[model samples]
Target: MRTVQYELMRPGELLAEKERFSVAYLPVGPLEWHGPHMPFGTDPLDAQAVARGVAQKIGGVVFPTLYCGTERARTPQELQCMGFEEEDLYVVGMDVPANPVKSCYFPEEAFGMILREYLLQIVEQGFRLVVIVNGHGASGQLATGERLAREFTHNTPATVLFTRAMQKLEEGDQRLGHANISETAMQMYISGDSVDLSQLPPREVPLKTCDWGIADALEFQGLGNAAHTVEQDPRDATAQLGRRYVENGVQRISDQVLAAYAELEPRQGTKA
Candidate 1:
């Protein structure tokens, strides 16, 4: 059990643990709709909570959460009702958008470059493994993440591990989506008061509702829907459930992270 640690290593601490197990865990989330009940940062926050618990359990460093994504747009109707001639502003994690208009959105390549730069710096600081947890749950992000992980590891001794890689080490079920039970519950646990369950948007509506269906299907032009927000029946979520989800998810990640560390240990001439 590698002493279950995280990024508390200061300058002196770093020197103290030159041979200590080192890993950096980052959480990736986007600012977007999460129904009316949950806050916009639900996805990333949920992932962060899970990552922190895992770091505590497996001796890993938890880095700050990244909220940027490809592109984000508010539906015309939501904008109208919110009384916004433009996109209303919201904060996902620590960053407040310049305008309500999705500013964090960018090309996948650009996002990858940002991630690569961040990891490269960490590797230079002597970290042996970098674990990134993407709560965005987009298949494109996951696919791209895999490629980035490979490229990152190919270029350096530092290894990149994404949340999905954990599934291979554990039999447990973990989903990658928003507003689902897992996400809603996790939000409830993370910030119960901030979650306005009373204002939850209506569910049980036809899937073909004008918002996403036949008729004037609105393609967000060239921008992707990375920051676009939507929610499930988050009002139905409970803090108890949120805690359970976080606990379970963290365990899954910790299990996989430990396995990865073990597999890479021999190459580094270290033992766990």
Candidate 2:
């Protein structure tokens, strides 16, 4: 009912919104293949939905989701631990093989520059409080965003908040991962029948065995078995469960955003 989408609103309407909240939400994610069962826009979709939800709770303008993101590459040896061959193709974010269409990812340095510019533009648009709702969790992606948030806040008058759309759940809750249950459920809630968990094989088929899907139970050189990286069965996820996660994430992110927004100095109107 209420509109927070920045691209959808007129300049006058956006100015009124800025006058009221001076907050802007950027949903950042990459255009990577989630799985054959799911859509490629899964990550950004999740971020966009949550961004709108949080913006509704706390007044703000939600930008059309940013499809650019960063990621880390896993060498042949590393992927071997995940049941791959000894030496072969390279894998990028989320244990996905970087063959022809590896995932839409930029180098970390380039990604940092891209995000830095986005933050600068948001601040330039006269938004005093900026919220970056990240959906992709590649280690490099996370670092780049955090570094930019700190830099932007320290260098500019505007305050920036970088947070994950799939925020951490309570202790013992299911861990989120690439195309995992948590994500699938969120997509189910957001896109309805667009994301068919039915496309996934029967319950007997293991996710780790798949070629382009989830990589459950990963083990790194220094890191032990990281089951949380890809935990839970998507089939077990329901639309209701999806709603619960989405709602909880919006609540948590909104709480953090509101508390921080409150501490910033009162807005002085949009820039001329």
Each candidate: what lDDT? 0.57, 0.77
Let me know the TM-score candidate 1 reaches against the reference structure: 0.69
The TM-score values for the models, in the order shown, are: 0.69, 0.88
Report the lDDT tens digits of candidate 1 across residue range 1-272: 33233354476655554466678787876665554456777666776777777777767667777775443234455333322344554423112232233224556678778777777777777778888887764444676677878877767777788783112123433332345445666777888786765553456542211132111112112121332322223445577867776777787888778888887756664321
Best by TM-score: 2
Against the true structure, whose lDDT is highest?
2
TM-score of 2: 0.88
Clashes of 2: 0
Runs in model 2 lying further than 4 Å from the true structure: 75-80, 95-101, 216-231, 266-272
Candidate 1: where is the Cα deviation over 4 Å? 1-9, 71-103, 164-176, 201-232, 269-272
Task: For model 2, give the RMSD to the true fold.
Answer: 3.6
Give lDDT tens digits, candidate 2, residues 85-137. Answer: 54666667654553235567889999888888888888999788899999887
